[model samples]
Target: MQFGDFYYPLPANEPVLQYAPGSKEKAALKAALKQLKSEKIEVPMYIGADEVHTANKSTMHPPHQHKHVLGTYSEGDAGHVKKAINAALKAKDKWANLSWENRANIFLKAADLLATKYRFQMVAATMHGQSKNAYQAEIDSACELIDFLRFNVHFLSEIYRQQPISVAGIQNRVEYRPLEGFVLAVSPFNFTAIGGNLPTSAAMCGNVVVWKPAHTQVYSAQLFMRILKEAGLPNGVINLIYVDGPVLGEECFNHPDFAGVHFTGSTGVFNHMWKTIGENMSKYKSYPRIVGETGGKDFVLIHKSANPDVVVAALLRGAFEYQGQKCSAASRAYLPSNIATEIKKKMVAELKEMKMGSVEDFTNFVNAVIDEKSFDKIERYIKNARKRDSGAKVIAGGKCDKTEGYFIEPTVIETTDPYYVTMCEEIFGPVLTIYVYDENKFDDILKIVDNTSPYALTGAIIAQDRYAVELATNKLRNSAGNFYINDKPTGAVVGQQPFGGARASGTNDKAGSILNLYRWLSARTVKEVLTPVTDYRYPFLQEK
Candidate 1:
C-alpha cells in the first residue's frame, strides 16, 4: 500500500449533542438505558483474540443507583497480566511493521462507528456504569472518544511527515518508530473517554498495549473494546484485562518487555507506580516512557470587575458538572470581596434549583459520586467544614445520603482562611470552597492560589478588566496547564485545549495533541552521503 503520498483529512473536534427535552438523542438514550437495565452483562478479559474468564468476578453497579446490578466482570490476577504482556509482545512485530495508513484506517473506522451506529449505546453505557447524565455521557464517551481517535490519526500523520533537513551531498531523514516493546495503559474511572484514549492512543501509533481499565469503569471499557474489534483492529494489538492494580503493576513493571506506561489517575498512585518502575528499571529492555495525568486542585479566581452572573454560572458548571468527577473540575475559588456577595447570592439561588439523583432522570443536574468510598470521603470534608467555627462555614447544600446510592449534595463552603483544608485538598466530588479576598489583595491572593496545592491541572481567571486578566494570566502562568479567561476551568476539548498539567498533576504530556503522540515514539535519524570518500581524506593535509 502507498504510504507517504496518502493524506488523510484533518479532523476537527466532534460536536456534542445536547440531548434536550423531546430530542431524538434523548429518546434514543432512554431506549438504550432501558435495554441495558433489562440485562446483566458478563464481561471477560480479552487476551490476544481470546476472551478469557476467571472464577473471580466483580459486580458492576451504577453510582447513582447502587442497588441495581448492571453486570459482572471477570477479575484477572497477576498471571493474567503476564499473559496480556506476552500477548502484546507476540503481536508487536507484525502490528508495528504494518503500514501506518492501514492502522490509521482502523481507528478512523472506530470513530465513525462510535458517531453513527453505536452512539446511543456508548452514551447509555457511560450513564449506567459511570452515573453521568445524558449530556455529560454524550460529550465524554461519544464525542470526546471520537475526537481522540480522529485527532490522534491526524497527529500521527504530522509526526511521520516531520523529516530532517538534508545538506547538499547528504540525504537526511527521521523515522518515528513505536516503542520497542509493549505499553501498559492504566486508565481512570471518571471519564470513559480517558479510559478509551489512554490505550488507543498508543495502539494507533503502532504500539501494542496491555490495558487495565479502572475496575469501576470496566463496563463502558468493554464497549470501547468491542467498537475497536468491530472496526477491524487486529487481534493482540491491544489486550484488555481486568485485574487488581497492585497485582498488574508487579507483573508488568518488572517485565522485560515493558516499554512504556500511559496512565490517568490519582497523584498518590502515579507516584507509587513511578517509584516501582524506577526500582525495576534494570529489568526492562529499555528505559520505559512514563506518561500520566493525575489529580488536580483546580481553581477559579474572580476579580472585582467580573460579572456576578458569569462568575456564578462558571462555578456552577465547572464545580458540579459530572458531580465534580472531572480531573479538571474547579474545586476552589478565590473571589474579590467587592463582587463576592452578589456572586454568592446568585450562585446559591441557582444551585437550589439544581436537581440531584439518578442519571435515568434527565432533569437531575447532579448525580451520585462514583461509590461509597468517594461519598464517605466527601461527606467527611463537608462535615468538618460545617463543624469548624473559625475558618469555614457551609454556604449552600452540605447534606449527603447513601441509602439508595452514594449521593452527596452539591456543596459550597465559604472559608475565612484561604488555606482551608477543603481548598487545598482534592475531594473529587461536588464540593467547592470559596475564599473571598480583599479587592486590593488580588496579587497576594494569586500567590496564595499558586502555592496552595501541589497540583496545577486547571484554573480560571474571571475578570472584565483587560489589565486584571493579563496580570492574572501572566502571574498564574505556572499555576494551571489549562487556563481560562471569563470562563470556567473545566470541559477541555480534545484538539482545542490539549489538556494536561505539571507539578504534582502529571508529566504535562498535553493529551489530544501531537505532544502526547510524541511520547509513544522513538526517533531514529538517517543520513546517506552521495559521494563515497574511499581515499581516506588526504585533502586536509594537502591543503595545510
Candidate 2:
C-alpha cells in the first residue's frame, strides 16, 4: 500500500469531570464501583496473542478496604519474562516497518475510544483499583491518558517532519526510525495514566514493548491493554505481563534484544536497574536508553507577603490530594515566621474539617495510601517526629489505623530545623512538614531548600512581591522540573508542562512532550546526489 501524507486531529487536554453529587457522572461512577465490587476478575499475562496463565496468583485489593477482594492476577516468573521479550522481538520488524500513518492511526483511535466510549470504564478502574476519588480518576485515567496518546501522535509526526538543510547539488532528508530492539516499560501504581503512557509512548514511536506494571496497578492496567487491543494494536507489538520486578529485570536486562527502559518508580530500584544495564552493556546489540522518573521530596515556600489563605489552600491540595501519593506532592514547606502561625492555625482547622475515607465516598476529600507498606512508612515518619524532642513536632492529624484499610491521617509536622528528616525524605504519603524561617532570611532559606534534598522533581514559591518571586525563580531554577509561581506543585498538565526532573529525580526527558517520543526513536539522514561527475582527477594536483 502507498503511504499517504497524514495529519492528526488537533490535540486538546481532556476536560476533568467534577462528578458532583446527584450528577449523571456521579451516578455512573457509583454503578461502576458497585459492579466492580460485586464481581471478581481474573487477569492473565498477554504474550503475543496468547493469554498465558501460571500456577502463581496474587489477589488484588483496594487500599481503602483491604479486606474486600477486587480480583486476582496471574503472576509470572522469570520464564514468562523471557517469553514476553521473545514475543516482542518476534513482532519487532513488521511493527517497525509498518507505515507510520497506520501506526499513528491505531493510537489516535485508542485516544478517541478513551475520550468517549471507554471513558467511564477507565475512570472507574482507576477509582476502584488505585483508590483515586472520582475527580482524581477523571484527571488521571480519563484526561491525562487521553492527552498522552493524542499529544504523542502529534509529537511523532513532528519528529518525522524534522528535515536537514542540503547543499546545492544534494537533497538531504531525515527519517525517525524506531529503536532496533524492544523496550521494557516499568510503571508505578500511583497514576493509571502513567502506567498507560509509559508503554504506549514507546509503542507509538514504532517500537515494540514488554510492559510490566506494578502489581497494585494491574487492575486498571488490564483495562488499558484491552483498549489498545480494541483500537487495533497488533498482537505482540506491546506485550503486557504481570511478573515479579527483580525476576523480570534480570531477564530483560541480560537479553540482547533489550533496547531501552521507560521507568517510573523509586530511586533505589531505578539505580539498581541502571547499574545492571551498565554492567551488562556489552551483551546488547545497541546502547539502551534509560528514561526514568524517581523519588521527589518536593517543596512549597511562602513569603511573608503571600496570602495565608492561598498558602493554606495550596498546602491542603498539594500535600493531601490522593493522599500525597504523587511524586510531585508538596512534602516540605518553608513559611515566613511572621505568617507561619496564621497559616498553621488555618491549616490545622482545615485538616480537622476534611474527611478521610474510601474513594467511593465522594464527600471524603482524602483516601487511604496505596498499601500497608506505604501506610507503615508514613506512620513511622510521624512517630519518629513525635519522639524527637528537639527538631520536629506533630502539630496536627498524627494518627493512623490499618484495621479497615491503610489509612494515615493528613499529618502536618512543624520543625525547628529546615533539614529535618521529614523535610529531607520522600514520605510519599499525606504528610506535610513546615519549617518557619525569618522574613529577612528568605535568600538563605532558598539555598537550604535547594541543597536539602537529592530530589528536584516539583516545587512551588508563593510570594506577592514581584522581586521576591523573581529572585526565587532564578535562585531555585534547578531545584524542580515543574516549578510554580503562585500555585501548588502537583497537578501538572500533560502538554503544557512536559513533566520529569533532573539530577536524582530523573533523566528529565519530559514525558507527555516531543522530547520523550524522541528518546524512543533513532534518526537516519539520507543525502541524494542529483548529478555524478565523470572525471575523478582533482584540479589542485595538476595546477599547483
Candidate 3:
C-alpha cells in the first residue's frame, strides 16, 4: 500500500472573475439567475442513500425580494438528526480507511467543476438566496469556495508529510488518523464559502460529517451538496440535514459518537456548544474537538496624518460591503479630529452615489440584510442612535425600508460618547459608529480602542505615518487577530491571511490554514524495529 510517494503540491488561489458588462460570465450568470428564478426547486435532506422529505417544509426567498419564492427544503425533527448521525457513523470506517490520494482527488475534482461548469450557477444561487451582489456572490460562492476546496487539499497533504525522524535500525512515522467518530459542521448564512468549507474540511481529513447549514443558506448549500455528489462523493460520507438547532444539538451532543464540531456563527452559540460538550464529556468516545469562528465588533482607527480620501473609501467599502454582515466588517471607528470633518463629507458624498437594491442589478453596491429578523435588529440600532439622549448623531444614510426587501441604507453614525451602545455592540449591519478623537491623543485613543470591545477579530489603521502604524500595531496587538495597515479591515483571502480571532471570538483556530485541519486529526506515532530483538531484556536492564 505504501509503494510510492504521492504529493499534492500547493495550489494558487482561484482567480476572481470581474463579470464585466457584456462579458461571457455576466451573460452566463444572467441566464442562470433567470433560469433559477423561473423554476421552483424542492430540496430534500440527503441522509445515507435516501433523499428524505417530510410534510413539514420551509420555503426560501431572496432576502432582497421576499415575495418571490426560490425553493422549499424539508424540515426535520430530532429523529432526522439521529438518522444523520447514524448515517455518518455507518459510513465512517470505509471513508476513513479509503486511500488518501483518492479522497484528495474527489475534492480536487469538485474544485474544477466549480471553477468551470458550475461557476455561474453557484454565483447566481448566492446572489438570489443570500442577497449578495454579483461581485460578492462570485467572490464568495465561486472563487472562495473553489480556493477552499483546492487549498485545503494542499494544506492537508502538507500535514500528512510531516513524519517524525527515526533512529538507526528503526523506522518511525506519524499516521494522521481521522477522529474516532463523526463530525458536525454548523455553518452560518453569511458566506457560502464558509458553508462549503466547514463540512468539506472535516470530510477531506477522512472523517464523515453531518452538515447543518443555516436555514437561510440552504438554497446554495443544497446546490453545493449536489455538486459534491456529481464529483464522486459517496452517500453518507457527508449527510446534509435541515433541522432546528436545539433538536440537532440535543441529539449530536448526547451521542457517544460525536467526534468534533466545525462551526462558524455567533459567540453565544459556540460557548453553549462548548459548555454542553464539557457537561457530556464522559459520554463521548473521545474528547470532542470544537473549532469555531464567531462574532466581532471590527474597527477602523484613522490617524490625523492619513489621507481623507483613502479613509473615505476604506470606511465605505469596509463597513458596507455585503451590507456589513461579515464578522470582520468594520463596524466601529476612531477617527482623528483633524481629518474627521473632511472624511465624513467625502464618505457621505460617496454613500449618496452608491445604489441600494436587489442583487439582480449589477450596479447595486448595497443589498438587503438576511431576513426580517436581521432587518428589525438593524433598525433598532439606528432608531436607538437617533434618540435625542443617546449622544450619537446620524451623519449619513440612516434610512430603513422593508417595503420591497430587507433594505437598510448604508448608515454612518458619529457619536460624541466613546462608550455609546452603537460603538460597543456587534451590530452586524451597514450601520457604522464613529468616535472622533483629538489628533494629539492618538496614543490615548489606541488604548480606548483596545478596551472598548470584547472581541478581538479584525481591525485596520490607515496612516502615512509609519510610527503611528507601528504604535497602533504594537499597542492594539490583542485588539484584533487580523490587522490591516493603510487598508480596510475586510476581505481576507484563503491561504494568504488565515482567519479567526481570540477573546470571545471563538477558538482562533485560524481556518484556511493547517491549524484548523489539525483539529479533526488524531496522530499515531508508528515505530518499527528493523533489527530483530535477540533477547527479552534491554541493554540497560542487562548491564546496569
**Whole-model lDDT for model 3 versus the true structure?**
0.93
Per-residue lDDT of candidate 1, residues 318-421 (tens digit): 99999999999989999898989898999999999999999999999898899998888999998898784757999899889999988888999999888889
Q: Which segments of model 2 are wrong by more than 4 Å?
A: 388-390, 542-544
User: Could you give candidate 2's per-residue lDDT for residues 1-544 as a string of tens digits?
Assistant: 7766676655888888888767888888788888888999999989999988777989999999999998898999888888888889999889999998899889889989998898887888898788888888899999999999998998888778778899888999988889989999999999999999999999988899999999999999999999999999999999999988889988999998889999999999999999999999999999999999999999999998999999999999999999999999999999998999999999999999999999888888888899988888888999999885757899999899999988889999999998888989899999999999998899899999999999999999999999999999999999999999899999988889999998799999999888899899998888898887789987877955
For lDDT, candidate 2 versus 3, the one ahead is: 3
Candidate 2, residue 81: how far the Cα is off, in Å: 0.7
RMSD of each: 1.1, 1.1, 1.4
| Pairs clashing within candidate 3 | none
Instruction: Order the candidate numbers by lDDT, best to worst.
Output: 3, 1, 2
lDDT assessment of candidate 2: 0.91
Model 2: colliding residue pairs: none
Report the candidate with higher lDDT, 1 versus 3.
Answer: 3
Question: What is the Cα-based TM-score of model 3?
Answer: 0.98
Best-performing candidate as measured by lDDT:
3
